[model samples]
Target: MLEIKNLHVELEEEDKKILKGVDLTVEPGKVHAIMGPNGSGKSTLSYVLSGRAGYEVTQGSAVMDGVDLLELEPEERAAAGLFLAFQYPVEIPGVGNMTFLRTAVNAQRKARGQDEMSAAEFLKVIRERAKSLKIDAEMLKRPVNVGFSGGEKKRNEILQMAMLEPRMCILDETDSGLDVDAMKLVADGVNALRDDGRGFLVITHYQRLLDHIKPDVVHIMADGRIVKSGGPELALEVEHNGYSDILSEVA
Candidate 1:
């Protein structure tokens, strides 16, 4: 469903290039895991894929279903059924969670020429998803991510993903700050979304999250490029021995 070829990206006004000739392909009904050490350009790839501003694409192209993704605006990307779950979710002080969620849903609906959901319908659907994610009803009434714990914020991100039902979903460090229980909750949410028509790119550092998600393919990235690609056993190898051996082979 998504293909990135020779992808090169660099930050604006900076001399250093972050991503260099990275290539990846994700098909529907499968999960792919990207594991890399610090400063490996994992997050940069995420920002670039999601169309976050200020990250200049120096070369290459990312295509989704025959469309050039880099050429579209951020909202345009989202409207095209792309969703990015951030590593650090920002808190909005004045916007209620429900209100923020409803606005996003309605905006996408409008872009797709669908009617805006009434408050009653929106509330009902959100309630169902929130319940499945273990989000309290009271929490939805508060400002977006305000005073939420790290796990709570991550769960909120997944909640948004479930509500949007994107065709391709990118989870950036989704298990970074969660406790074991919280991780299980988030993983369950992701597993529930696995279907024949959807794809997931799960970016994480540890094998623990991979234990829960069980990606169909595991890729090791280094120095701004994907150095090694393998099956689930590769993740287990990384878990036990780290990236030293794989780095040697790839180099």
Candidate 2:
């Protein structure tokens, strides 16, 4: 349900090009994994799509189900069904997790012209979703990500995804700091939300996460663009051989 065509992006301050003509299409009901080296612009693509600041789209377009995503503000994009789980979730020191979630949920609902969830209804749903992510009540009462371990932060991100139920999910290195068990829990949470109406763009550095999520398409990105597209085996190939072989072949 997401389509990008010849997308080019550059850093606003430095004017250095990051994404050079990236063309990709993510169909509904499929998970697409993007595996790339450190500077391959995978995160840049996610940031631009999410409408983050300090980047300029020099050319091309990104649209979700025919709606131009590049035209919307970040919150507008989120309201339009875009959810990004960050590589490093930031700490909000004074904002309680449940309070933050409720505010965000209601804000999106209001943007979409929907009724706000009652406090009791919201409590029930967030609790249920948090339970699935192994988040305890004490954790929910804490300020968002404040003093949370890496695994807990990541799990909280998944919890947010579950509650939002966005159509297009962009997980930028969600596996970055997770342990084996924590990774499995996060993956299970993602898989539970998989459906015919949803699509996932998983950006990761390694294949270990893919072993759990099992993407429908795997993309190898290099030098700011996608170099190869294949099935799940492509991730395994990267795991065994590294990016050297593919980079050379594509070069």
Candidate 3:
């Protein structure tokens, strides 16, 4: 459902390039994992796809289900079904988590020309979704991500993903700073969302996250481009031998 071709992105404030020609496709219902070291442009790829500002697309196209994501604004991209879970979720101290979520959901609906969900319906749906994700009602009443534990922040993100039900999900290091139990909880929430109508692109550094997420395809990225892609075994190879051997071979 997501296609990126020869995407080259650089910082808007300077001439330094971050992504140098990345091409990837995540077919509907499939899970794709991208593994790379720091500064390899993995997170940049996600940001570019999600239409984040501060990065100019110098070349290539990013299309989601035939819509050119690069041409749309960030909110437009969200309304068109794109979701990115950050490595470190930012805290919005003044806004209650529930209010932020409801506003987001209604905004997406409004942008799509659909009817907004009623308060009763939204509350019931969110309650059910939160319970499944092990999110407490009190947490929902608190300010978004403010004073939450690391695991709580991650789970809150998954909760957001569940509520939005985006067609294309790009998780950037969702496992970062998460404990084993918290990681599993987040993975289970992700797994629950798996279906033939959606796609997932999981960016992570460690194989442990892959153990739970079980990506259908594994890609190795270096120097702002995707250099290699294989089955899940590729992640195991990296875990066992590191990127040195693969980089050497590709070199």
In candidate 2, how many Å is residue 199 off? 0.3
Model 3 clashing residue pairs (backbone) = none
Instruction: Write down the lDDT that model 1 would get.
Output: 0.94
Per-residue lDDT over 116-145 for candidate 1, one digit per residue giving the tens place of the 0 to 100 score: 999999999999999999999999999999
Q: What is the lDDT of candidate 2?
A: 0.96
Q: Could you tell me every candidate's TM-score relative to the true structure? A: 0.99, 0.99, 0.99
lDDT of 2 by residue, 100-122 (tens): 99999999999999999999999
Clashing residue pairs, backbone N/CA/C < 3 A, model 1? none
Q: How close to the true structure is residue 216 of candidate 2, measured as C-alpha lDDT? A: 100
Report the C-alpha displacement of residue 2, candidate 3, in angstroms. Answer: 0.8
Model 1 ranges with Cα > 4 A deviation: none
Among the numbered candidates, top lDDT falls to: 2
Cα RMSD for candidates in order = 0.7, 0.6, 0.7
Pairs with backbone N, CA or C atoms under 3 Å apart (clashes), candidate 2:
none
